[model samples]
Target: MLRIAGILLAGTGAAHFAAPQVFDPISKAAFPDDTRQWTYRNGAIEVALGLALTTKKTRLLGLAGTAGYAGWLASRVRANRGASQ
Candidate 1:
């Protein structure tokens, strides 16, 4: 289960780096030109956390990764309010 989740994270992170423009219009505050850099940084973090989640020696990293993912999702929801809000 952990490995699957990790792979999902890494895959999405790769997509972010490879096609950041797909994510650009969702932002509420970031400048247009800075989006790709932001995407790449996020991709790096996701890849790192995903890698960290792959072993018992670093199991604690899974907790941190979960927290980070939760926070990231919450932020996206908050920042992209529309008729649902």
Candidate 2:
């Protein structure tokens, strides 16, 4: 289960680089013309976290990181709604 989730996370991260335009809207919401750089940075983080998730020794740490990442995402949603969390 962890491996599958890791692969999906990594794959989406790779896609951020491969088909970045698809993610441009999300990036653009936060950045202006320089969105790709941020996208790449986020992609790299996702890839690293995903890789960590795939390794048994790092799985717990990865879970923690992922949870934090998720919190970041949730913040985005809150920001979009102009709501506090």
Candidate 3:
């Protein structure tokens, strides 16, 4: 399960970086009016973290990265909602 999640994270991260326009719709739906731009750097970081997580020694790092990313996304959603109101 961890491996699958890691692969997915890496794949989605790559997609976001390689094709921002494609990712933008998904991001907009999830984040509403939050205007943060998803860039190649974000994708690279995710991929690196995912790779690290694949190794037993680096699983914690991967989890941390995932958690941080989730927190960021959540914050964006909240901020967008707050701004609209």
Candidate 4:
């Protein structure tokens, strides 16, 4: 059960990170002229962390990465909304 949870969490995190590139057309249409390198970096890091989560030895790292990513994502969402208004 724990392992399954870990896999699910890791996969979701990875998807969040890759969202921009995976959905490039949508992103470009929504946010024209926004070409940030950090998005790709985030995706790469998330993929690495997700792979790490699959191993017992790196579970802690994976959890930490997920928590950090979630916090960062929340902050970004809040900041974007604040700016739009």
Better of 1 and 3 by TM-score: 3
- 80 Cα displacement, candidate 2 (Å): 5.3
Q: lDDT of each structure?
A: 0.67, 0.80, 0.71, 0.60
**Where does candidate 2 clash, by residue pair?**
none
User: What is the model-wide C-alpha lDDT for candidate 3?
Assistant: 0.71
Q: For residues 1-85, could you state the per-residue lDDT of candidate 2 as single tens digits?
A: 9988998898888899999988876765544546788788778888988988998999999999999987886666556552221
Residue pairs in steric clash, candidate 1?
Answer: none
Report model 1's TM-score to 2 decimal places. Answer: 0.66
Candidate 4 lDDT over 1-85, as tens digits, reads 5467666655754675656666444333322335345445555666677776778898888788878977876666555553433
User: RMSD of model 2, in Å?
Assistant: 3.8
Which scores better on lDDT, 3 or 4? 3
Candidate 1 lDDT over 26-57, as tens digits, reads 43233334556766777777777777777777
Provide the RMSD of all predictions against the true structure, rounded to 1 decimal: 4.1, 3.8, 3.2, 4.8
Q: Where is the poorest 10-residue window by lDDT in model 1?
A: 24-33
* Evaluation by TM-score, superior candidate among 1 and 2: 2
User: In candidate 3, what residue range of length 10 has the lowest lDDT sum?
Assistant: 29-38
Leading candidate by TM-score: 2
